[model samples]
Target: MEVAKILHMVGGVGETSYALNSTLQKKAMHIAKPIVQQSISQLYCKLQPTESLTIADLGCSCGPTTFITISEIMDEIYEVCHRLSCQVPELTFFLNDLPGNDFNSIFKYLPTYDKMVKKEKGSKYAPYYVVGVPGSFYGRLLPEESIHFVHSSYSLHWLSQVPRGLEDDSGAPVNRGNIYIDDTSPPAVIKSYVAQFKQDFSTFLSLRSKEIVSGGQMVITSLGRSDVDPLGGEVNCLYGLLAKALNSLVSEGVVDKEKVDAFDLPLYAPAIEEVKELVQNEGSFEFYQAKVFELNWDPFDDQMDDFVADSFVSGENAMKTIRAVMEPMLANHFGGAVMDALFSRYAMNVAEHLKKEKTKYVNFTVALTKRG
Candidate 1:
């Protein structure tokens, strides 16, 4: 699959769109806000007094949190300038995502966002400019040495493509009966995924190193695994459940089994060590902070839980969140006819699994500085 073409959050402001279904992502951004603020502040201290500052938010999908994140970063910079008695710099903001992302949804809110910044910052607000640049972050997307700070959240785990060599010499699927790397996947499948991550991440760092000025800072938060072993994390369980749902449909002849075998999600939740190794090997940035954190599987589950009743509701909510992000790619690959049924089965499987045990998503946040 061509990930650049197919990977995008569900568009529009309707019920199934990412705008409505992204509470989990919003929560993740809130959790990482403090780190983001600190990174900006520190980078500000290192920056020479200038009339303008350029910042980029990579993988900024359309949602309330997209503007929220930009606002928060601007606030941090304003605070730093206040303390130093420096004139607030003119702000140039680049909001980037895959080309297929819903830029219109994000653009619609810019007027309100600008007014909010002006209201909060008063006369001290910098002359702010925002532009949408659509492309993959795994390659160069900006002019050289232009960005002073970079921030990305709840992205970066998505690989550029499904890892190569998931087929045998005769071209049969090697990862049969599984849609992702699982405990049962062969060592070859595991190695292929890891190798892909290393290459993609290294390229990401290299391109950013060229685009960011020396001493600039980058903060990233993405779905990751706490376990050193790639196969032993909550992400594996999540995809495993998805695979089960697909298998059930295959059994009932509602979906083609061979189609399932040919499909693999273009995602990999890297271990912290693997991330650290890539940063070190790439030799362009200093890793200032790297930590793993946990979030509940169902971030929206606030009500009282009757194991039987709430499980279904919680499962449905979880499925919606996944659907908002994954549905586009799935529908393109698996055909739209089966999606409603596929997710229905997925919801039940998740509901049943949650009844037995609580599940959490492991997340990793890292802060880096471009080397001189």
Candidate 2:
């Protein structure tokens, strides 16, 4: 099914889609700092030709965050070049993501980058060019062995498509009363999502490995869990929240209670161990670093509170908003009945929770390098 159709069926993009790029800025450059530093270090230590250097930001959404990431990466590269008394390479950076992504917004910000680069060298200067590439990162998006450094944030955890059985008879099994379970919900569910992630990630690694220079490095950050168990509690908690939200809609008559009760969520957030397994199984890369940190929302407490308020002040309003937000996600993940109650409950809970505390989570970032 088309991405649009999937989204429409599930409901619509909800608070999750709210200014996504802007929110990501809260995550630091430190997690991926080593890879950026290493790539530059390799260029200098190996006396690699600067003319061949290239960097890419996969899933580069349009916003100040993208620019910030690019700036930090370039600075890291420049530091290495400076230490070696070498002129910076002719840099060609690729900004890539889904075809529907906002290319215009990204390009609009490009000219400013040119101006900013000049400020770096003062009287000195370096040549850097950036272009936007539109495509799914699941397949080969670049020429073989053409890139030197790559980075992706909050993208890999997304399955290319929702697994087939997600909306099938097993839907309720994936939902534990008040909450929803993730791809790792049950042994069976875990198998389903793991199989999908394995396939998607394998393709991702194979394609990226071919494009990345032998010594090139990459850092990818995703919504990750702390355990490998398909039935882990954290997984259940998140699903439960979403399910609870959906239940609120059902009660309001915006969605048929029966329909809301039947749906199931198709996405999964893997544990650090699972991610490490993916890297090792691909067998082309060496692990350099792995770090997990809690994604905090204390700073955005106000914004989150407002989002909760606007979304679920009443049954009808909440259902309307949820239907719109969930349609696309449902279609993408494959629709099912298990998630209805789970999502409804999530909406109601958010409304209630905002009356008190804030929302927060723990996430992970992993960095790797192909064997030189």
Candidate 3:
């Protein structure tokens, strides 16, 4: 599958839209707000640009979370400038995502977003401007040495394409029953994923290195695992359950087993250290700090209890969240007809698993600066 052509969150502002089901991403961003604020403050103080500052939010999906990020960034800049007694610069924002992203839906809300920014900035700086740049962030998207600060939240885990080398010499799929890295995945399957991440991330950093001006900062928050072992994380169990849901349909002869065997998620959540080492290896950015945190799979379940208080409700919410992010890809591979039933089965499986153990998604955030 051509990931750039097909990968996008469910669009529109409907019940199943990513706009409504993106609380998990919003929560992750909120949890990493300190890092974001610090990065923005550092960039502002470091350059102290008086005329203009350009920012880019990579993988800016069509959701409220996207605007919230831009808003928070502008507010932080305003606060930092006021506190430091410096001139607040005119801000230019480049909102980037894959071509398939719902740029129209995002544009629809810009009028409101612009009004809010205008009121807050008052007469100090010119109005904040947003440019929707549709393209894969894995490559160059901005002019050379143009950006001041970059922010990407809850993205970058997705590989540019499905990992290569998933098949044996005889050409049989290596990971037959699983969709992502799991306990059952062989050594070759695991190696293939790591190789893919290394290549993609290095390319991303190299391209951005040419775009972001010297001393500019970048903050990346994406789905990740804290565990050293790739197979030993909450995300493994989550996708494993989805694979089981597909297998259930196969068992019932509702879908072909070959199709399930052929499908694998084009995503790999790296460990926090893995990201640091990759940046160091790429030789473009200085990795300052990295952190790992976890959130309940049901984003709405904020309590720290070790038990699922309402398995059914939690399962429904989890299903909706995953569906909003993944339905388009699943529909592309498995056909739109199977999506309703497949996710229904997935919900039941998640509910059953939650009854046994409450699982969460591990997240990683990194702060970096482009080397001069």
How do these models rank on lDDT, best leading? 3, 1, 2
Candidate 3 backbone collisions, by pair: none
Q: How many pairs of residues collide in each model?
A: 0, 49, 0
What's the TM-score of every candidate structure? 0.96, 0.77, 0.97
| RMSD, one per candidate, in order | 1.9, 6.1, 1.3
How well is each residue in 261-311 modelled by candidate 2, as lDDT tens digits? 445554567788877888898888888777776543322333423244443
What is the per-residue lDDT of model 3 for residues 1-372, given as tens digits with 9 covering 90 to 100?
899999999999898899999999999999999999988988888887567889999999997998988888888988987898777788888999999999999889898877776776787556668999999988889999999999998889999999999998998898998899888889989999999999999999999999999888999999988787787767889999999999999999988898888888999988887888889999999987777889998989998678898899999999999999999999998899999999999999999999999878989889999898
CA lDDT, candidate 1, residue 184: 81
Better of 1 and 2 by lDDT: 1
lDDT of 1 by residue, 1-372 (tens): 899999999999887899999998887888888888988888878774888889999999998978878888888888889899989888889999999999998998899877887887788967989999999998799999999999999889999999998988999999988989988888999999999999999999999999999999999999988888888878888888999999999999988899889999899999889899999999999998876777767768643243344788878988888889999998998898999999998888888888997677889889999999
Stretches off by above 4 angstroms in model 1 are: 302-309
Model-by-model lDDT, in order?
Answer: 0.89, 0.62, 0.90
Clashes of 1: 0
Candidate 1 yields a Cα-based lDDT of: 0.89
Task: After the best TM-score superposition of candidate 1, give how far the Cα of residue 180 lies from its true spot, in angstroms.
Answer: 0.6
State the lDDT at 48 in candidate 1.
47
Query: Model 2 RMSD to the real structure?
Result: 6.1
